[model samples]
Target: MKLVLDHIGVRVGRSMHLDDISLTLEPGSFNLLLGPTLAGKTSLLRLMAGLDHPTSGKIRIDGRDVTSLGVRGRSVAMVYQQFVNYPSFTVYENIASPLRLGRRLSAAEIDRKVLAVAEMMHIDKLLDRLPGELSGGQQQRTAIARALVKEADLLLLDEPLVNLDYKLREEMRAEMREIFARHTTTVVYATTEPQEALLLGGQAAVLDAGRLIQFGATLDVYHRPASVRVGEIFSDPPMNLLAVAIERRGSGVVRLSPDLSFPLPSHMRALPPGPCRLGVRASHVALAPSSPADIAIPATVELAEISGSETFIHGRHNDLAIVAHTAGVHSYRIGETVALHLDPQRLFAFDADGRLIAAPERQPGTVSGAA
Candidate 1:
């Protein structure tokens, strides 16, 4: 089954919850809606699941307009961030409740379905355990079993791993991916975690302030963001953006900064003349023994952090504080003078309007610079 949303919007007084949201999900594809807190991720999910109606526009499933459909009318199962199992019921009874309450199966059928789901979720061992008896992770597994037992055409998960501890969350994420691999149901996962979005999504939509910032394949969103905000949202330390003026040289070389300048690749040379931002990831910011004559800026190391696998050096230059992460142990004494070398080809150029002007063309070993 296919799910399509077209120009759907929801407004609440002075606040617009969703603005012209549009997306089409293929059958069995795992899709993610990701954004920062209060970005309306949950609101969009609820609207898609028919639990809430948009103020305007439509939602269609298999070409049938379901904008006015109620939650019960839509063939979807939602697993929420909160583990809402029945406190008084055992794990077996909780997993079987959906089957029993729906009345589509006999007692024998319900038992078989419940057992199968429990086994798939690795919760069969806790069949006799109540919600209180099981740990947080087990309770979440039971809730998931219940969701899967219903056999809906679409699976809706709203931050389903948010309630679990770090280790448990990782484990459950792996299990969830396995479950998706075995089923052909369309899955819409909502999360604020960029890593989780990449891990689970075949496609993803980046939402910000109810606006669809960008939507496409996971790698596409990361490698070629639609705007500066998008590039900032996908990296850990975030993409390092610096203001740069485009100065025309006889041969397409633009003066990027007071201490840095590089020839505009053939692609960016003919582009419109205007103000722009230069972006590079932490990994691309190179530190040399001294500033190069062509381009270099004096910076003072603010701090140096060693985190086992890599070292992070936070420093300041030209009134700009920058963070750089490199593999293995590196040493930079606090308050020491240093110079940074940024890869010209690795830079992303954005216009004054914050829209992407030119992005780094992918080459081997390029890290999608910062979220």
Candidate 2:
């Protein structure tokens, strides 16, 4: 089912929930709705699912206007962050309920379909257990199983893995990707996590303050953000933004700061000298070497957090608080002073109005760079 939201708007009393949002979701493709809390991700999903009415615009599926259709009239299934399951029914029965609704399916066929989805969800061993008897992860798996077993044409998952533990969330993300790849359903997933959006790569629609900021292929959106706000939203540690004045010299030298400057890239020399914002990702910030880059700055380390295979170093550079992501285990004490290197080629420059003025060249397999 190809779903389209044509200039949809939702207003509740005096508050506007969504404002003139427009998007088209291709059939059998995974679409990611990304935003922060109260950014209207859920409200937009509800509009598509017919759980709420849009105050204006229209909703269409495959060229047919379904704006008037209620939830019961649509072939859709939704899974929420909080697991929703029948407390009285066992896992097997819960998954089979949708298949048995107003249809005559033999017990053998029902069992086959139910068990298939249960195994796919890694909850086959808990088939006879009730919701109360299962762990939080298991219970959520049961809810997901129930939703997938129906084989609905449209699947809406609203942070379905958010309730799981860290390890379980990682495991389930990979599993869900595999399951979705095998099915041809049009899946729409809403998430506030930038990593999750990248992990479930497809198309992405970024929302902010009930407005659709940008939408396109996930990698394209990440690499070529439309604005500074979009770049900040799509970054994990958040993009490091710095206020700087650009000074263009006749010799092609561009000064970014009083003490920092480098030869401007061939394409950037055309920019007029003025004030702009520089955006750099944490991964692009590196520890100073004996022979550092020309744009190195002295900074004092404030904090260091080591997790898994990376260390996040937070420090202060002049008046700016900067974060650097480095691979492997590293230790840094508070008050330690270190020089940081900034690669001009990997930097992004935004105009005074927060519009992207320059973007770094695209490189494969590099998710952390200018946008």
Candidate 3:
């Protein structure tokens, strides 16, 4: 079933939880919603599932207006991070409870349907086990099996993999994608993890402070962010933002910072600017052993972190703290003086209002000092 949210807003007590959010989910499409805490990602899911009524606007399912419909009236099912299962019931009983309690089905039919979903979820061996006996992952799979056995039209997952370890999370992530692909259920997924968003959903919607920031294809939103906030959201090390003043020098030449100067790109030369923020991803910044004349800035490494597959080096330039990430291993040490160079061509500037500005053109005769 296709799900459409139009101007949906939810208010709890005096505070607004979701504000004028709008999205349309194509049938069988996986839509990922991401945000920080209090961003209303889960609130939107609850509204879509008919668990909570919107204070304003409408929610439509398959062209039918279901804004005021109750949870049971809408064919939507939700599986939350905390697996909701009956402690006293066995796995078979938990999976069969929905059918027994809500729908009219014969004993033989309920058993057949329960067995089918159990097999599909790989939880057949745990049919006789209670919820407490199963591991967290197994319990979650049972909850998912309960939903699928009912053949829900819309599947709402609220950070279903959030509690698992990295390895189990990865394994369940693949399982979820495969199950959704086979069943073709309209799905709305909510998560704070950017990697999970990109891995599960073809399209992603970013929410900030209860407002919808941007929504589009995952690659489009990641590579070309609409604003500085959008750029800072998806990346691992986060986007580096620096405050600088833009000054025009010698006709069309523009001085971005006091020490760093370059000619403005043809498009940016016409803009009026005073104070601007430069946004660059951590991967775009590099360190050079020898300081180049024009592009490199002197910095002192304050700290370095070495993970299994990546290394993060934290350094300071003037009053700004910057971080750079590299794969595998790095040789930088704390208190070492390093020359940091930013890729000017890949550098992005945003005005005080958070609007992105085009990078200036590279100098014709000058070569880039660092990679």
Candidate 4:
């Protein structure tokens, strides 16, 4: 179903939970609602599911107004972060319960549907086990199976994998993607993790403090953020921001700081001269030899953290603290001096109002420094 939120706003007492949010979700597309805690992701999902009402604006499905419909009135299903299940019922019974409600089917048909969804969730073997007898992940899978069996027009998942173990979470993420791809249901998934949004590879709507910050294709938003806040929120280690003055010099040179400067690309020659914030992803910072297009800075390593496949090196160049995300395990001691290379093409510049001014196009064969 095509879902539309027209300037929707939710108010609880004197506090506003959602502030004039407007967006249209296409049918059969998986839309990710991404933000940190208290960013109103859950509240927005609840509103879409008809569990809550908007104080202003309208909610439409397929161009028809459904603002007054309750949860039971809409063809929608929801799964929360918490594992919700009927403790007394077995997994098969739980998944079959929704199918039996307000509908009549032959015994064979019900059994066939139940077993199909059970197998898809990888809980077919645990069909006879009660919720109390199953592990947390198993119980959650049963809940998801129940929701999927309904074949609802819209599916709302609010961090359903948040409580699972790291390995299980990774496994479920891939499985969920495949399941959703095969179905025609419009899905609205909520999560606080930026990596989850990227992995899902769908349209992303970034929410911040009850407001919709930016909405677009996932990779487009990541590559070219609309604002500094969007860049910081979408990044894993977060985008490194440096306050600098833009000096338009002869021969297309721009000075960012006393120790850091680079030749501006031809496209950025028309940039107005003034104070601007330089934004660089940690993955773009390197310790390798400087290429002609790279800006090198001498800095002392303050801390180094090695995490299996990658190492995070925190260094200081003059008064600026720089973070270099390098591949594989690397040894570095505190106070050790090293030259950090910054690729000119990978840099982002933001105006004084924190709005993105320029984001250079990513070139082919460009290596990501951050894991």
Candidate 5:
């Protein structure tokens, strides 16, 4: 099912839910709709599911117009954040309901399909149990199993495991990926978690406000965000941005501060000397210098947020606030002076309008220097 959204936009009353969004999901392609709250992730999913109509543009499945169609008119299955199931029906019955309603398969075939998906979801032992008899994670697995049993051409999962605990969510994500690889259905998954998108390892359509910000392979999009806005939204702690003045020497160079400066990346050699923005991921910033070329910026610790086995040190480098995501839980008192080391090679460059002009070399697409 080649899905195409031709400049789709959704307007309700005075608010616009989607704006001039155009995208294509190849048949059997797994894609992620990534954004924060009110970023139009759900709106786009609803429009794709045929639950909502676009105010403008068109939608096509396999080049056939389906813009005006409703959910009942398409071979689409959707699983929401909440675990939705028939309260009175057992897990097996719930998984078989779609087959029964469509009247497209015999009882024996439906039984086979239901059991297979149930096992795949690791809920085979709970088939006879009702939704109320299962744990939150089990109920979600049941809901997902039901969606998978339908064998719908398109599957929309709107944060299906969001309600589960941390351990359960991690477990479910690995299984979900394995399941998705076996099915040829075009999957459109929506989530607010940037880590989830990265784990999925597929193409990503990043949304902001009501507009389509960037769309491409997940890692490519992550390493080379089209703009500062995309970088900020795609990052977990958000990318740290520093305003700097670019000064071109006889060759290529940039002056970030009186004591900090480095040669311009190869890609930015032709950029005129003036005001520009530098973006570096939190993971790239360190509390200690890693190399001789590293720039040590003196900062006062503002906050030290410890999550799991890592600590995110929030510091103020003059007027700029930077977050350093480092391993192990480290303690730092407020107003403590620390030098944040930055690697010039990993810096992302952006222009005055907040658009990215040069991206550093990254994995898989690795180059000798910055390009």
Candidate 6:
């Protein structure tokens, strides 16, 4: 199904949950809605699923207006962050429930569909078990299986793996590509993690504070964010931002401090003079200088967060706080003096209005400083 949301806005009394949101989801295409909590990811999904009517604008499914349609009238299946499954019904019956609702598929056909979907979700062995008897991951798989068994026209997943354990989440993440590849449903998955958006490698629409911020191919949005806000929201640990002044000297010069100044890259040549915001992804900020041309700044380490095989070093360069994301475990003590190296070519130049004027050239797949 082709899902088209035209200027969709959801207003509840005085509060705005969605503002001028417009997107067209092509048939059989996989897409992602990424943002932080309360960013209107769920609200947008509800609008897409016809669970809630928009206060303004229209929603069209396959070129036909469906803005006034209710959830019962559309061919849609949604899985929430919470594991929702029938506690009393056995897994098989739960998976078969949707098919039975139509009262069209025979018992034999229902059994075949249920068993097939259960196997696909790796929950075939637990078909006889109740939701109460299964592990959290198993229960979620059952819920997902029930949704998938129906093969609805649109499948909406709102952080479906978020409640699972780390290992289970990782396991499911690996299977997401293969699992979705088997179905023709227009999949719309929501996530707060920038890494998950990249890992999924689909079209991504970024939302912020009830507004649609940016939308495009996943890598394009990651590599060339439309604005400073998009960069911060789309990057893990957020993009490091610093206010700087740029003078229209030879090749243009940006002065970070009295002692730090460098010629801006050609991409930033069109930047308006005077004050500008410099954006550097945490991944591109190196811990040490690779060459003399690399700009080095002295900073005091504030904290070091080690997550499995990765380490995030948080430090402050003067009043500007920065986070450096890198692979492997690295230790740093509070108050330790360290040098951060930044490549001018890899810098992002934003206009005073926070709009992106220039961005580092796209490189090979690298995000959160991980390969």
Q: Candidates' TM-scores?
A: 0.89, 0.93, 0.85, 0.94, 0.96, 0.96
- Winner on lDDT (2 vs 6): 6
Would you list the C-alpha lDDT of every candidate in the order shown? 0.82, 0.86, 0.79, 0.88, 0.89, 0.88
- lDDT (10s digit) by residue, model 3, range 250-280: 5444454456566654546665657777777
lDDT of 5: 0.89
Q: Clashes in model 6: which pairs?
A: none
Task: Residues 1-371, candidate 6: write the lDDT tens digits.
Answer: 99999999999999999999999999998999999999999999998888899999999999999999999999999898999998899999999989999669888999999999999999999988999999999999998998898899999999998999989998988788788887999999999888778888789999999999899998898888899988988887888998889988877888887777788776788887899899998878889876777888788999999998988888887777888777789999899999888878788888877888888777665554522
Tens-digit per-residue lDDT, 1-371, candidate 1:
79999999999997799999988998888888878888888999899889899998899999999999999888888899999899999999998887776556788888899888999999989999999988999989998898889888898998999989988998888788889888888988888887786667579889999999999997788777888888777665677888767767666666645766667765466656656787777777767522343245567999989886778888787667777777779888999988776666667888888888788777766444332
Candidate 1, residue 30: the lDDT equals 87
lDDT of 2: 0.86
* Residue 84 accuracy (lDDT) in model 1: 83
Q: For candidate 4, write residues 34-121 as lDDT tens digits.
A: 8888999999999999999999989999999999889998999889999998889999999999988988988899999999999999
TM-score winner between candidates 3 and 5: 5
The 10-residue segment of model 6 with minimum total lDDT is: 362-371
Error of 1 at 249 (Å): 1.8
User: What number of clashing residue pairs does each candidate have, in the order they appear?
Assistant: 5, 0, 0, 1, 0, 0
Q: Which stretches of candidate 4 lie over 4 Å from their true place?
A: 364-371
When 1 and 6 are scored with lDDT, the better candidate is 6
Stretches off by above 4 angstroms in model 2 are 251-254, 289-294, 368-371
Give residue 351's lDDT in candidate 5 (0 to 100): 95
